[model samples]
Target: MRILLVGAGLSGAVIARALAEAGHRATVIDARAHIAGNCHTERDAETGVLVHVYGPHIFHTDDEGVWAYVNRHARFRPYRNRVKSTAQGAVYSLPINLHTINQFFGRTMRPDEARRFIEAQADTSIADPRTFEEQALRFVGPDLYRAFFKGYTEKQWGCSPADLPASILKRLPVRFNYDDNYFFHRFQGMPEDGYTPVVASILDHPGIDVHLDTPFVSDMAARHDHVFWSGPLDGYFGYDLGRLGYRSLTFERFRATGDWQGCAVMNYGDPDVPFTRITEHKHFAPWETHEGSVLYREYSKACGADDTPYYPIRLVREKALLSQYVARAAGTGNVTFVGRLGTYRYLDMDVTIREALNAADAFLHAVQANARPPVFSADPA
Candidate 1:
């Protein structure tokens, strides 16, 4: 089968490579000029900093398979994601650990003390928390939630905490441990030459023909054995079921003389702050030192036709819209929706690669058994 992978991101590239290895012809294409999609990283000519072209992507995964898979393409350094949050005019370590709690409250409490203190502060009234606000109140209490998450989250989603689902907040770590490493992944690191080089190499096979700066959706109507679409689910069907909501980011970049924020990522949790987070590119690659720094003040906004979708705002309405898209995808023969935009869901780089690999395996199995390969990689419902 000649597999047409309609995006050169992690998902498409992985699946493309996998399909080619499995003795199938695979061609990868992307609208963007580069291969890595949002994870594209390049050297800043002026500042000599490795700038994350789309945004800062911290590759962290617990799955050894996924870690090993990525490491094969590019050598990874020992990189731990350490995030900070700024609220009420002070910066604190993120993931709401003991240090963050102690610093936020102006109390030098130990891990146990802080844990107990938070439990006491937590709202016991919210028995079965449904909304984001209630969930946060139940877990970290109102004061902490308000100071750290409420406004920031509201800004990111463009909806009040009460309107949003509790599951969104679940992604955020509420830890009692003194350890400040944001992710619990065993192997976490950035690519040696950055994401672009890794993804470019992944799609370098003779079987894979990359048509960059070329949108695949326009040519989707053309004949192909199988179309692996990694674009937005809604866009595939011409938005007939209405546009699916997505939280997009606008990167406000600036050059600085010295270290900015002293870390790779910094969250602005205050209502007064307009941006969701500020990412300093210099600190991302610790092996290389830069005299100055380049930073991106990430502002979260609603996604329009022109805007790039960073995060999927899977609200109730969006989910319903996704359902229609999913149904449309299934009925549409010789096409399978994959990746973040394809499924209209939030996915990390590791998860995307894993799913793509799984999709390829399942596809091979389907061919062997004379069954149908999955139209959608993961369940949208």
Candidate 2:
């Protein structure tokens, strides 16, 4: 069977490799000149420092299978994502933890005391929150919400917290103690070399043929028996159901002497601040030594036709449009939609790879059983 995989990101690369290993012909194509899409990393010509072209992606996950799969390609260095926030003329830790709570409110209460204190501070009146602001208030009350989430989320989404859904804050971690590890994933680290090399190695197989600077058109699928599309779902249908909403980013790069903000991610959690966070690229690769550092001020805005969509806005209109695309993709036989763009959900690198692996497993199972695989790997429609 000949399979045409679109967009040579993690999802496409993984699925393509799986199909090829199954004794099937797989052709992977990416519009960009590189294999890794937004996660593309390359050495800076002047500084010689490896830079993440889109944003810093920290490899962190608790799934043993996912961790083992990536480890086969490259060794991972021990790394933790400890983020800091600059808000209201001061810098503090993130995720509404005990340290963040004490620092922001000028209180040194113990964990139990702090929990009780926050419970009292919480707004019990709003039992069920419909918006982001109300959700924050119910969880941590007004003061902390205003200090941490309210402004930053507004800046990131380009909308007031009241206008956004409370589901946005679902399952966000909050610590009782001073443990400031950003993610609680069991396996958390950065690739030894970099993401680009690791991704390149994943697509390095004899049976798999990769074409960079190549875009997959609908006509390309005619020659192939199956299609695995990682591009935008609406793009597959040519936006016939109207374009899905997404938030995009613009990175302003600059060189600076000494440390910038003393951390990798320094978020500006104030509505007045234009950018949501500034990331110090040099700090990302902690093993490397550099005199001069590179930083990126990440500004988020509504996505345009030409712009790359960083985060999907899963609002009512967008969800309805996604349903239409799902229907179109389902009706169109032999084509499967996978990954963040196809599903219209903002997925981290780990989640994307995880889904890809699942898709491969499902495809193999279907091939053996002589059944049609579902259009999506994670969830259908």
Candidate 3:
């Protein structure tokens, strides 16, 4: 079987490797000059620090199989993502931990005390919170919401928290204890060398052929027995139903002599600060030491035609547009829309890999059973 993978990112690479191992010829193509998609990493020419070309991507997952899969390909150094925020003229721990709660209000309250204090401030009137603002006010009250989440949310999504869905705010946890780690995953780490090498290794099979800087055309689909589309969902359909909204990111790079922020990610919670967060790349790989440092000030904006899409803006408008695309994809044949862009959902690296693996398994099972492969391996809705 000849398989065509539209994008040479994690989804494409993982599925390509799986299919190739099962005696199928896999051809992976990407419009970009390099593989690994947005997670592509390269060493800074001047500073010698390995930089995340797009942005900081810390690999963390609770799935044991996914963890083992990445570990087999590349040496993963244990890296915990401890995020910080600067708001109201002071630096504080992220996720609104006990320390952050105490510092922000100038009170040294214990865990139970802090919990009760926040509870008293919380709005009990909002019975069923629908929007981001209501959810924040219900949980942490107005003052903390204004200081930490309100400004940051406005800048990140390019809309008031009042307009955004409450689910967005629910994704982030508010800790009563002093746990500042961004994620609560059982396993967390970064590739020892970089993500590109890890992906390169996955696509290194004899049955696989990779072509960089090659965009997939409608004509290309006919050449393959099956197609795994990891590119944008609307892109697969030529956006006939209208473009889905997405928030694109632009990084402003700068080099420094020593440690810049003494941490990997320092977010600016103030809306006045144009950029959302500043990431120090050197801190990502703590095992390796470098005299010089490299950092990026990440700015989020509405995605344009030419801009690289980072975060999907799945508001009311985008959801309606996405459903149309999903229908179009279903009617189309011989192609399985895979990965974040294909499904039009923001996915973690682990979730992306897990889905890729599952998609490959489903395809193989379908082939064995002499049945038609699914149009989508995962539900876009």
Please name the candidate that would achieve the greatest TM-score relative to the true structure: 3
RMSD of 2: 1.2
lDDT of 2: 0.87
lDDT of 3 by residue, 120-213 (tens): 9999899999999999999999999998898999899999999998988888898999999999999999999999999999999999999998
Evaluated with lDDT, which candidate comes out highest?
Answer: 3
Cα TM-score per model: 0.97, 0.97, 0.99
**What local lDDT score does residue 75 receive in model 2, on the 0 to 100 scale?**
90
Model 3 pairs in collision: none
Per-residue lDDT over 268-308 for candidate 2, one digit per residue giving the tens place of the 0 to 100 score: 98889999999998788899887778889999999999999
Question: Tens digits of per-residue lDDT for model 1 on 182-296?
Answer: 9987888988678999998888788788888888665654656788888888888888888998888898999998886788998989988889889999888999888988999
- For candidate 3, the TM-score is 0.99
